[model samples]
Structures are given as C-alpha cells and as structure tokens.
Target: MFIRKLWAYLLGYLILVIKGEHPERLINLAYTRGVHLWDLCWIDAGTLTAKVYASSFRTLRHIAKKAGCRLRIRRKRGLPFLLFRLRRRRMLLVGAVVFCLILYCLSSFIWTVEVSGTRRISQQKVKELAAEAGLRPGSIRFQVQRDEVVDHLLRELPEIAYAEVNVGPRSRIRISEKQLPEPGVGYCHIVAEKEGVIESVLTLAGQPLVREGDVVRKGQVLISGEISPAPPGQDEQQGEQLPPRQEPRFVQARGIVHARVWYRFYGEAALEEIQERLTGRKTLIFRIKVPGKEVIVYGPREVPYQFCRLRTHRYKLQRWRNISLPVEFVTIEAEEVRHQHVRRSYEEAVEMAAERARERADRGLPREAVTVRRRYKVLGGDEDPVRVVLTVETRESIGVIRKFRPENQTDKTGGKEGV
Candidate 1:
C-alpha cells in the first residue's frame, strides 16, 4: 500500500468528484478501459468521489463523460504539484535552503558544558579549567582536544586524581579528587574525648593513665606518651652503686579506652498543626523556548488556582551525535493544593514527640557505640505542647590523640612533669 502511494505521489494524483445519474457506470467504464481508480466512495445519490493517477485522469474523464457523469477536480497532491507551487514562490525555496545551511553550521559548535563526579572542588572551577583548555561552549565539538582538557584539569588542580572529558552535544567533564591523609603529630597522648566513666582500657603503645571504673573528664589524659625508665633494682641498691637517672622517652600514644557516655536529646510536637494537601485538580501549559526568549504555545498563561504546586519538564528539540538544536519544549503542570488544620490526641502527640526525640538522639550516637540504656521523660505544663526528653547511655571508645612535648631538662628531685 505504501509503495503504491509513493508511486502515485511521484507521478502526481488528483481527487475528482463525479456528479450525474449514472456515476456507478463511470467506475465500470474506467475499469474496463484499463484506467486505475482508488478510494472510490459515494458522496450522495448523484455524487461520487475517487482518486486517480494524474497520467490516467484524462482517460477517466473521457470515461465519465461517456457514462453521463460530469467530473470535477477537487484537490491535487504529490511532489510534482509541490515543486510547481515552490516555483511560483522562489523566496520561500531560498529561505528553506538557507535554514538548512544555518542548522548545519550551528550543529558544529558546543552549546552546553557539564561537570560531574566532583566533591570539594566546585563544578564551576572545573568548567573554567576546561574552558582554558579550549573545550568550552561555542568551541567546535570535533576540534576540541579531550586529552588537553584532561591534562589541564589534572595539572591545574592537584586535588584531582583522575579526570575524563567527553565532547558531544554537551561537553561533560568527570573528575575524581585525591583523598589526602590527615597530618600526624610525633609525640602524642590519648585523651578522653568526652566526660564518661571508664569501662576498660587497652594500650597499644602508651602508658596507662586511667583505670577501670574511674571517672574521666574531657581533655583528661587516658594514656601517657612520655615513658620514664624504672629505678635501679634492689640488688643494685645493695651494691652501693646506683645507675644514673634515665631520661623520659617521647612516643606516639595509641590506645582504645572504652567508656560509658550519655547523650540528652529533646523534641516537641503540637497537638494541632496545619498541612498542605493536593486537591486533585491540575492545569498543563506548553511552551517553546529559544536562545533568548520563551513563548507559550498552548494553555492559559496564568494559573487558575491561587495555592498550587508546579512541576516543569524540559526537552531539547532534536539531537544527533554531537549536534543538538537550541530550541526546547517545556511543559509545566500546576496542581491545586489546600492547607487544613489537623488535630491529634494528647497520647498521639506524645508518641510523635517521643519518636522525634529518639531519632535526634540516635543521630548523635556513634556507629561503633554500643547502647547501654535509654530513658524518656515528659516535661512542661499542660499549656505547653507535648515535650519529650530522651537520655541515652552508650559504651564507646573515648580515647583521642592529644599532641604534647616533654620538657628537655629532667628534675633531679624526681618531680612529676606537667602534660
């Protein structure tokens, strides 16, 4: 069917209306005379419609006349007729050709630049670096060197460990930042990070300063990094000769001090609250956006509802390989909404407040901490909203490295050194 239509279009075709007493006879006569006719239908008792190839229309007209029917051409279609029409409007033909050339020229240049996989390093910074390497917007997509852009990023930004550049309709620059280790201190002590009751201590390379069941405050040393040698033994003392005083050695402290820590979290919820909900009514607006301006193509310009939510979707006109048109189709959907006051019972409000408090407390808890106990309490008077205070106790390692330097001179009087 498509091939037959293409053949008809290449040779041109005409739609004719036949009006007479014996229009049916015309169809028979045309078929008997070897003239092709298609889409035959009766418009009325005296009128009929049919499509015939332009080359065979003259023969069909003769057949119609002999069958006592008058033929009238209704419409003309096909490429031949289109070319004839364009021949009369030469400027339209020229404009079409110019549009094609402009489209082809615009497709060669880049329109958008995108950066992904960046953290700590700003996307704008990466884009600027890429622009310096000649891979920015308006640059030729095929001519921009991806390797140069990658190299420029890696060199200009020391934090970037890896970079990849892809040039197409939109230029994309992907980068991975180098993970740097934290600076270290040579001589350090393990100190309590928070006030807690010590449960146990495990020393890896430090002097124990706190014992089990002892209460330690924040910043208090849990382990000492300075080590002083033991005094001479009883046998050496009896020999009447004592070894010289030994100097304290400074070392990096490493230990784990598990302690019980407490966290207090508070939350409240009102028995009455206002919430917004959708009303199920929506309006859709379609628009076309060009480089400099946007035009509404369909739907109303102003939203009908005063309180509403808006969602927008945008689509580019056309894209092929590294080429994309500047035109975009935008659809905006506005949904009507209404706010209503909702009332909850006292028990429900208390539960809600308690859940919020629990969540807040859990967020503050460390991943390695083991939960020991939890307690919840209600606070405030009846006039106040339901309030909840949550107290959580957990056992966790409280030791943290604290750097310090020991005094160069040791006191002969055997006085303890200050940390």
Candidate 2:
C-alpha cells in the first residue's frame, strides 16, 4: 500500500536534475541560505548538461552566484510522449481491469446447455438432472467436469441409455440424453419392404430365403414365414386346387434375420447462414455500485440493432469467490443479422441426399442389418433442389409368422365343408 501511494505521488510530478560546468568556489558558498536562483545561466565552451542533487534551491543559487558560471532550474517540459500517456492513464487502467473481470465471469457462468435425442425422457427432466449436477444458470463452468457430470447423470437415471456432455467456447455446456428401450408389444418382423440383391444374410429368427450371394427384387422374401413339413411325405393329405396358394401362409415363429438388401433413397437440404461485422462504430462507459444501489455508467444511448444484448462483468478474488469488488462494468452489444439462402454444389448436394437416404433406410430397416454397397446420383435441378437418387444395400432378414387353426379354415368355407 505504501509503495503504491508513493508511486502515485511520484507519478503525478516527475523529477529531473541538470547541472553546469563549475567546481570549487560554488561549493564554499553553499553554506549560506536565503538566496533565490529561479533564473540563472552558465556558459561553457565544451559541455552544458550536468548532474546535481540539492536539498533546496537557495543552495543552488548561492553556488551559481559564487562561481562565474550561470545556472537554471525548473520543471522539465516538451515531452509530448509522456504527457499523452499520463492523460490516458485512467482509461487504460480501467480497460485492463474490465477485461480481467470479463474473463473471470466467463469462467464462472454457464452460457448455454443443449439437450438432444430423447423421446421418452423429458427435456425438463434432463435439465433438472443437469442442474442437479451443477450446471444451472450462473453455475461455475471452470469447476465443472463435463464428462464427469454426464457419467453421474447416467448413473443416477436408469432411463438414460446414453448420455454425453459438451463444453464449448465462452463457457457453454451442452448435455445429450438417450432414453432406455421400452418393452416390445410383440415380435416385430422386418421383411423386405422394398427389394434389392442379397449380399449377406444374418438370421436372428425364422427361416432364411436367400443366402449370402443371392439377388432379389422388390417384395422378394429374404426370410420365409412358412415352416417346412417334417418330411417330404409327412405332410397331411389335402385336396389340391387350381392355382397354387399365391398368398404366403404365416406360421407362429420369432427370430431376427440380417440380409444385404439395396434400395434407393433421396434427401434435400438448404445451406445458408448470416454473419456480422462492425463498421468502425464503437462506444464505452463506466459505472459504480454501492450497497443495494444501482445506476447507469453512462447516459442512455441508442445502439445499432433492434435487439440489444447486455452482458455484465464482475471481479472477485480467486480464493474468496463470495467477496465481490464494488466496481462493475456492463457492455451492451447490438448485432444485426442478414439472412442469405446459399445453395450447395450439385455434387455435394447429391452426396448429402444419398447419405440421408441411407440413414432413412437404416431407420426403417432392422438394426441387425449392416450396410455393404451404396450408389448415389443426381437426377434433378436447383430452385426445386437437385434430385439425389441413392441406392443402399444392407444385410437384414427378419420375418413374422402366425399359427393356422382349424376354426380359421372352417370360417373361410362358411362351415359348408366342415364335418
């Protein structure tokens, strides 16, 4: 504290000492007092500038009068560099302090949190869990470990099948939650809704139709719903009718089958975004706060944008976080965004659409299937968005079955042929 005060005082008034060419006679007269030497000059053929330290100006005058030399003393001037810096000292200091405050605030406050991919689990519940894990508004971002928080949430909530946490720039935290699997109503059969070549086959349940190296078309069965007779002749005798059974007879069965199947899919997406840049216009102000009191730093002023955003910055010791300094600064930034519709390249758009098609197919198909071959091509134009045709081949063979009863057969005949 003492050093700071001393520096402040010295800084207010700088010091410089200058001397001239003179020796013995000037030293002797120094003992006397009360003589003024505000204006004195010394003439030296070789050098004029010298160094000297005296307790009073009187002594300097005495020494000048005794010697045949001249002396002059006054505050130094003509230093425009020093003066300019001195004039802006307060501003520089305040700006530096405000910058540090902003950094501290960023480390302590949670700016953003995102929740995704949860249909069964409520977003509110996810937020609640995050808040409980120290991720609420104004929560300290520096003190929180995103991965650790996610793990904790997953452990605490059984409904969350998967969970993830992301920490972004400017103290933003994002949370991702996945819900647990619900009980299946019954065995869901994934048949060849559409068709393609069977590159591979994986049987999870029921009988398989086409094997690894087989080609199939639309409506072609990769897995059969019908059961083979115990033996070729073991089948019960029945009246043969004209036109063999065209409809597939469903038998009671449960299992999963994976066969490589290929189908076409399409997708379309728009690419456009807006950005902002300052046009050489900026303003700043300062504010102070007392106990339970508030006031504006500078007078109210209109900003550039219709929507204004205000950010508050504060300062406190790292170790003692509760004790905040009285000084505070708030910055308000107005941003204007212009909308633009950017269209992707024909090739790029086609590729994107094809990828989307493959993803959609995966969603529609059984999970047991694995993708093998994919082919995509553009078929249409811009404005309407280029048409992307995608053929994706995946391996999946799933089927459903139902048991046939004698009652069902009798009902088909209307009881006319029943005994």
Candidate 3:
C-alpha cells in the first residue's frame, strides 16, 4: 500500500512539471479532445507559477519541442520522494531540513521533571539515584526502567518510605518519609510550683490533685504522686496525737505548673503614625543540592517596587536537621501595596495602651492572679505629644516562708509521725 501511494504521487509530479513548461499545444489538444484538465501550479526554488493542465507528458513534450524548451526530469532527493519535473526542487526540499532542525532543538535541553514531592528527602539525592538507575538528562525517556529505578532509589535511602519514579520529556522521582518512633524513657510529675488560689490548672503528663475553684497558698502542694499513708495494720495505731513506732520514708515527684497570671501594659499609639511604603516588591526562588552547585529556578531582574521600611525573620538549621548542602538565596516580587492611614479615636487609643499594659503584667505576675479592675487617665492631646496614664489591679495569693534552715530549708524528718 505504501509503495503504491509513493508511485502515484510521483506520477502526479511528473505530469505537473510537463504541463508547466508548455501551455499552448496542451491547450489546443484539450480543445480538440473535448476533455478537461484540472488547474495545476509549477513550483521551483525562486518561482511559483501556474500552468494549463495537459492529458499526458507526451502531449506536453510535443508542445515543448516546438517551443525549443529543454525537458529535464529527475527523482527528488530525501525520504518521501522529492520528484521534480525540472532540474531544481530547492523550495520543497527545505521542509525536510527544517523538520530536522526542530528535532535537534528539542533534544538539546531538559524540559521538566515528571515527579515531585520530596520533602524530608532531597530532590538532588533522588536525581542522583535516578542517574545511578540510568535516568538522567539527555537520556531517552522511554528506554529507562521507571519502576525499577524508583525501587533502587528507595533502597539506597531507608529513610524514604515510598518512592515513585517518572520518566517523561524529563525524569523525576518523588519520595515519602517513614515516621520516626518517639523516644520513651521516663517522665516526672509537674506540681503547682508556686501555690495560690487554683484559678486554673492543666494535667499535661500526670494526675491533677487540685481544681480551678480551690484556694492554695505558696508552698502548698497542688498535685501529689506520692502514695498516701498505708492503712493501719493490726499492730499499728493511728491518731492526731498518737506517734508511730517506725519512721516514714520521704518521696519526690516533679512536673510543670501554670497559673492565670495578670499584667498591665501602657503605651500610646497615634492614628497619624509615619510608616515606610513600598512602590514595587520583588521575590525570587532557587534550588541547591549536596555535591552540586546552587541553581536559580528563576533568575534576578531589576525590582520596580519601592520600599519605605522592611523587617525580616530568619530560621537556622537545627542540630537534629541533617541538611548536607548549604543553599542560601533571597527572593523579591514587585507589589504596589503602600502604607496608608489607620485611624482611631483618643479613647480607643488609651484603651489599647491599657490592654497592652495588662498583658505585660499577666506575663510577669503569678498565674493565680486574676485581673479585677483597670483605671486610666488621658495624659495629653493629639496635637500636643499625646500621653495616657493607666493602673491595673488583680487578685492573687502571696507567698509566706514558714521554716528556714542554715541553707534556708530545714529537713522535717525530726517531726513525730502523724503529728
């Protein structure tokens, strides 16, 4: 079927070339034969001219003989036959050349990675494993063992739970991590560290021996892990005034304690405060790998945005974090957000200042303390350096030291049992 189609196309090209070079005789023959010929065009390197069709190449030959025009025919070069009636066929010939050029251009670079999602696992390490698995840049995507490659990569890093390897115009490997087991050694009970009215309490690790509504003073135990005195035995006697024959052993328990602490904060913030503005903002992105050079995913360019003030927070690699390569980069994106008015009333401003002062007091005061009252005075005006005065009161238990030693603590072992 292919060969027949090839021959048919060649015959059409030959007939077209013959009629293109001679038109007068072909026209005359067509008039006499009372037969029709379809419209045909003659194309060459520099010209695209139309021609009157002819029934046969022989009829076209007879006309060309009278005109003294040379008849030249040749098989076209390149696959899919480039047959030409004339000696030259350069215009159509360039198609094959252009197709080859496009093929070359597409093969020169890596287009994209097919798989992603390597969080705890490194992308570069996966790529390296892919390279070892025979999947890398310039490698034909179809020839690689994708599943086998993924299995191999996972085997190299036991830390990876599951891996998926994909091969497309580019190759990519995605990895998931297995959760690490928690370290379970031992724990201590956290008691009411500084006693007060039990405004609120939480049991993070051990049991709670006190409730929110209960009242407890300094040095008062809130939670107890130590076992209560054993029930009196047959020979044992127990009473408020009676003493035991044997000494009791001392036990220790440890834990955390938090209370409903209160505080008062004071500051004056004006409605017409001056702040820096940004005209254009810039953001960037980059990637780096161990044993590999840092790569910029998107390169840098001139930022069109303006910035009046800027603040930044940063995170450093923790001791347990095992990042091998140090990849550092910064990004900026252009934005038009600018500083504008954020207005409030004088009473509102004083209220905000008073609330801030309260927060500060809460952080510094004992947890048992509860906010009770707040007092404030407008110290100044908006035009004249504005000032605000504030006072906060809270209810809480105060500490009282009942015993002291040479070290400020006397062991109570000498006290009579049950006394």
User: How accurate locally, in lDDT, is each candidate?
Assistant: 0.84, 0.51, 0.50
Candidate 2 similarity to native, TM-score: 0.29
lDDT, residue 356, model 1: 97
Error of 3 at 98 (Å): 83
lDDT of 3 by residue, 1-419 (tens): 68754544554433234333445455566456553334344455322222322235466566556654544543222322334432276765687688889887776544665547666667777777777887878776667887878778756875554677667666566676543222231222234435445554433333456677676655665544332444544534543444343533223332333344333445565655655456555454333333356454564444334542323333333445665435444343344457777666776666666666556666765443446766666665664234555565565433221221112224453222221
Candidate 1 residue-wise lDDT, 106-136, digit = tens: 8889999999988788999888888999988
Regions of candidate 1 where Cα sits further than 4 Å from its true position:
1-185, 229-244, 278-293, 297-300, 303-305, 309-336, 406-419
Give the clash count for model 1: 0
Best-performing candidate as measured by lDDT: 1
Candidate 3 lands at a TM-score of 0.28
Clashing pairs in 1: none
Write down the RMSD of candidate 1 (Cα, Å). Answer: 20.0
Off by over 4 Å in 3: 1-263, 276-284, 287-295, 308-337, 341-367, 380-384, 400-403, 406-419
Comparing 1 with 3 on lDDT, the higher-scoring candidate is 1
